[model samples]
Target: MSSVEIKVKRLNSKDAQFKQTLLSSLSLPMADDEAIDLAVLKILAEVKAKGDEAVLSFTKQFDRLGVSTVAELEISSKELEQAYQGLSAEQKNALDIAAQRVRSYHERQKIEAGCHSWEYQESDGTRLGQKVTALDRVGIYVPGGKAAYPSSVLMNAIPAKVAGVSEVIMVVPTPDGARNSLVLAAAYLSGVDRVFTIGGAQAVGALAYGTKTIPSVDKIVGPGNAYVAAAKRRVFGTVGIDMIAGPSEILVLCDGASNPDWVAMDLFSQAEHDELAQSILLCPDAQFIEKVQASINRLLPEMPRKKVIEASLANRALLIQVQDMEEACEIANAIAAEHLEICAAEPRKWAELIRHAGAIFIGNYTSEALGDYCAGPNHVLPTARTARFSSPLGVYDFIKRSSMIEVSEAGAQTLGAVASTLAHGEGLQAHARAAEMRLKK
Candidate 1:
């Protein structure tokens, strides 16, 4: 098969202002697949109306699995045991190692109950305080695609478990009546309460709205395709959801010291994820840029998904030559890449300079892929420049804190006048009267 070719051209320094223009202009040429959207929506509505019957029909229609009832949708312990027993020793060992690292990293995020009180002499006999508590139950969605991501299952499930959430539910897609054994094993090992074989917007909708079979959950967390994102958006008010993720992306800030081959291979790490993935390089040395571009071309053919990488690079990839490292950092902060790789001489110093990014990989050895699989940092990251405001999935995502303010009778009297004055300024007579009544009591 003839592979797609990308021509690399040297950028002229005369167009310095155009550097930002070119960098900002780079984006994936993803034409929306509206047909898929319409089909998914119709299936989702049908599932909501027909419930389990509709789910079964779509399973057979889209997944070619003749699962006609909700009973079949549920994976039994025997099946899970069989899946675990079926894995090779090597695969089992790899999963064990990955889970250990992920669990250890998230264990540190656990929270403890907190309380505070204040007392003051106020001519009133009233007291008040606030309390915070964990949600009763939580849901996690793991995407079942070309390959099952055991890593994702760990990332989503472990945090909720640590957050003291009572129940943790996980849902994954199984195409053609097949589910990845590794994925099943991951859920089993992660202490997941229940694992259902459903996916896409319907799975999200079912979790959000609750069907006769699947119980509704307080929050849903995980990563999925565009349809899943849209479903999560629709269900936001009814239930809480993790951020809507975007395509994979990486920004490498390198100088002349980095190896061009290592850099090229690092770019491929995210490009393999999706055709829309973006890989960018910002360096002061023009010659280094050419070398890395050459390395990319040389390494492209070796990749199994070279066609996807080619298309990704042709559209979203960029080589930005800036005036210096400071300029590079400024540009990087503006983009707020999901994965920021700093390959400068003193990378620790440069890495500290970065203010906005989902995760940062410093030095040549700390490749972005390490964090994706086993570095213990959550791989379910914020994408589409959301790093500027949002954050990676962690224990904080699962827990909610209520302001705990308690006042003794004296404290109420001291605070009453201030509260009443503020409420009166806001033009709410009832609010001012409420505080005055407390004072009188």
Candidate 2:
């Protein structure tokens, strides 16, 4: 089948203007200092000083549905047992299946120690190898305000566990002190050692600085709101953070044979995420483009999240009939979408041609939704075109590496003069003399 085709149609200036406006609207949300920042600072200071008392106080002040003590923060086996009872039989089954798939996929990212040996004689012998090690602790922030995402719990926690982090802690916000049974279940199953019933910048501060109630973590990972992102930004130097993630995005590249219904639904999946979420379709078929637009108009109203989808479509959705697959790939790479679905016949072939994307979904049935939930891939991905430079959360994110070197007396003596010469060239008398002394001995 031919791979190139050019479709020319007048660009919608209004649509173009809308895309520009939406892209510019990527600003982080406003946080009042008196309301949020000061509160966060006080909580941070209190946690730093008093520890558990501060955490419990903030929990009561903010998440005042029922939790009154730190003990309430811990999820018990009884909670997990009841979680299955609350879920419909189908929902429970889906969670079980998704957990297995996600776990299985991430297990492949585990690494082992290896040795490299080499002998060189300058005046001595030397050997060098590199070793990788996991961190002592990691903190994961799960969004629990707008909705419950058990999948996120699995995606963030599984990687750290696989990386062999000594301790894994999770922080979640409960607006009215309501915990999602499924999320708690996922946490329990994922080997999370401790779960804190706190969130926002304060939660980040507690994790970064270490509180009496919550132990300080080495690195923090997960997706969150703009305030959460800004807080992560604020606390970056004190503690390591994964990324300052932006809104969710998806770009689908399709051929003339692509199904309009499928495209429409795929776009809806990202659109429903948030008003700022972007869903784009780039293809060469004018008919297919028009059909997908019509399908969006038809199916959007029928969905319960029509208002959110409508806002997202009006603000961030796009339908560009590009010149060809080559042009489509160029535009997709430029956008660097969090999710890229290639619905072309040779999806794998086309996927290889692309260079920038957080995750690539292939073929018609391989929709972005699968990656979001049960696909066994990390859903916490880079957004706002950062995928060009960033990668999805994985076992690698939780580990650190150090280079090892061993110099034999013979190797050091053989190489000493060269090292001394370079050190002397840099005008470092101490360094040169140190190597020279070793050589002399």
Candidate 3:
């Protein structure tokens, strides 16, 4: 424990005002969204109307790349290979391992999730089923403003490749023409077909609307700044987006048995993402909560991103004392955190009660950081309670399902009248006639 208090909010579930307080605290401030959206709208419109010329102009303005044409922005295939070959032995091995693991997991997910075309024949000679096909191409926007994320390239591109997408296009801003070698190496490893040195709403617009150099993609994945999020939201209909992700979040539901230091670091894992990120702890053990707080104070000062972690903790972090393990699970469901860690004596037992988290980490050793990197599961999870309805980014996002129907003469004779009646009842003569025409004369 340090002499300085961390000033993270403390709450007790037994209090009458606890739920209200917790819900209020969960709402991250959204003061700048309107401003960001307005700016993104202009960028999207410009890209839609002007295409490559607009992309080049915006790239010049934002990234400070004075390239005369959009073609100059595309990172060559040879450059990608060079990026991979130039890595140190350890870095190359790590990238290979992570890439292999991600590929294996997604390949398994493809098979296990039944991402295939299937049909069933009925006794009436009618066949009905679903046909699954991969998206032709996709664009992944890896945020390049704050930091370089080689992992994002692996996570986003690997799944699309596993799903058999024909092409994977990546766009990352190279501010002042500074490119991250690791990101390029990961892109090469993950089979990204195209890399463009561009970012923000302009990059999103270029991908969605299709500039002369950047072909239009069927969907866009990966994370970005506020402008990117707003741009994705605006162009959602034109191209599919993974999700409008919010800040990183981790909720650790721990029992007294787990080490307080381990638990504290787990919270820090998410808090270090940025000041807006949220780290929460739900524990029935009040004494353990105090121990964790002490550990946080002791270890926080040593973190490289100490200031970020401190602000995140002070802004949105929570150390809630629950009545028991059961209550903690209940609250965990309510929160639907992006990452949930059940660090308890019987982790699976507690995990069974969790239904809404984007991802669940069991046991004290299962840190969220592993999921963010080498862990097979895609770290691009739902956030801000979006996990309640949405799912983590996966191969399924890159595949489309089409309903297959082969109606036999006899089957159509029996079904056409039902359809005609319903269509007529809904006041549509054309629809009714279309169905009636299919009936046996």
Tens digit of lDDT per residue, candidate 3, span 124-167? 99999999999999999998887899999999999999999999
> What global local distance difference test value does model 1 have?
0.79
Candidates 1 and 2, the one with greater TM-score: 1
Q: What is the lDDT of residue 57 in candidate 2?
A: 73
The candidates, ranked best first by TM-score, are 3, 1, 2
lDDT by residue for model 1 (244-321), tens? 877889889997689999998888888887777888888899899888988887889988888788877776777878
Q: Evaluate all candidate structures by whole-model CA lDDT and list the values in order.
A: 0.79, 0.79, 0.93
TM-score of each: 0.90, 0.87, 0.97
- The superposed Cα distance between candidate 1 and the true structure at residue 55, in angstroms, equals 2.6
Q: Root-mean-square deviation of each candidate, in angstroms?
A: 3.4, 5.6, 1.4
Candidate 1 residue spans exceeding 4 A from truth: 1-5, 8-20, 23-44, 111-132
Model 1 clash pairs are 120-410, 120-411, 122-410
Q: In candidate 3, which residue pairs clash?
A: none
The 10-residue segment with the lowest total lDDT in model 3: 1-10
Candidate 3 residue 404 Cα shift, in angstroms, is 1.0
